[model samples]
Target: MDAMDVDYLNELLEQDVEIREKIKQQVSDLDKKVRVMVGILIKIHSTPTDTLPPLLDSVRPILRSCHDTSAALASLVPPNQFWRWKEMWSNSLRTAVYSAALVEYLSSGSLITLSQASEVLGIKEEWADRFSIAVEDYLHGLISLVNELSRLAVNAVTLGDYEAPLRISVFVKDIFAGFSMLNLKNDTLRRRFDSLKYDLKKIEEVVYDVSLRKLTDSTKSAVRK
Candidate 1:
């Protein structure tokens, strides 16, 4: 190649690196904010309803900040490369956690639907078209919530909150059913879907065990009375 050609290629390469680095920093800050929200969600998940509003309130501003960063990233990255860039942001799991938390909080611990996720993310049709962002991004996050709820079920039962396991079992089963209906193409998402069955089974077992214990306790009480 000519010297000018070589220099041109080098300059392009440097610009590409700079762009990636800038995106990395932005995404890193976004992820940190997401992490704080996730931490609050963990506390909220275990604590009683009375403790939730303040924690959830704390998350809204952070979520808005995340939304702004996401919009900026979407604008900066090429359409073809946006999905890949989103994966690199590594926010899917936390985003899903946030969605799950918001839905549960709003509905008194019920799972949220896709439409509700749009509401939670404050994503409108116009904004989605403008930013080229997909609702599937939030839906993908819900997959992570299934895993979390399964673990939560086991822990809830252990903590003597048997009702929690029942709720989780029903919710996880619904989520798994919904996932089964989709024609998911992403390898990571598909694999995560496959793994959900294990969580479903674990939560089911906990529910069964809790039911059996309650049954036994009732029988003992009847026998004594």
Candidate 2:
């Protein structure tokens, strides 16, 4: 590796550290938030219909922002479908907690077993298999997107360009839009999608860090030689 590669490596280290900190902070906050929401749901369980809207309204954004952007960066790894965990929670704030777990997982570039997800969603063993399959399918598309985008990013950087994939973002936006429409029809499903959106973002951000580190190291090595 040359000086350029070294520089790039250093930059990536910094970026990785930064992302780790951000992920940690976000996870801590999300945990507290989920607990509060769960308490609220329990308090208003008898009148779930009334508590549901306010709960959804308050938690919607957290659900929206937890997307797995790293999947886009990597191409082969599908975006983990945090939303699909909704099968366990079934129309409460389960969407939000799932998103939180998902973001935490994506941020770490880890695989979440169906059992873990099922447990988090309070789902039983029999139904978890079906829901796990659905999550995997959804994750497949995300992984494809991430892998393709990663290829694009690698090629672009090699060619001396480094712009975020706005086109890919548009694609993600459109898909989410469809889900949004679906949300309007069924609140449970909608919240599930919302969780997915946020989880993907976290994934993408981590993938970006990985790429930048690779690039920075590559460049620094070249610079040194």
Q: Going through the candidates in order, what is the number of backbone clashes in each?
A: 0, 46
Q: What is the lDDT of residue 178 in candidate 1?
A: 83
Q: Please give, for residues 9-89, the per-residue lDDT of candidate 2 as tens digits.
A: 999888657644554454455455556544543332233222335554554453443223111112221235334232332
The clash number for model 2 is: 46
Against the hidden true structure, what lDDT does model 2 obtain?
0.42
Query: What lDDT tens digits, residue by residue, belong to model 1 across residues 67-134?
Result: 56656665666545645455565454347445545546344767666556555544444444333335
Q: CA shift at 133, candidate 2, in angstroms?
A: 16
Give the 10-residue window scoring lowest on summed lDDT in candidate 2: 69-78
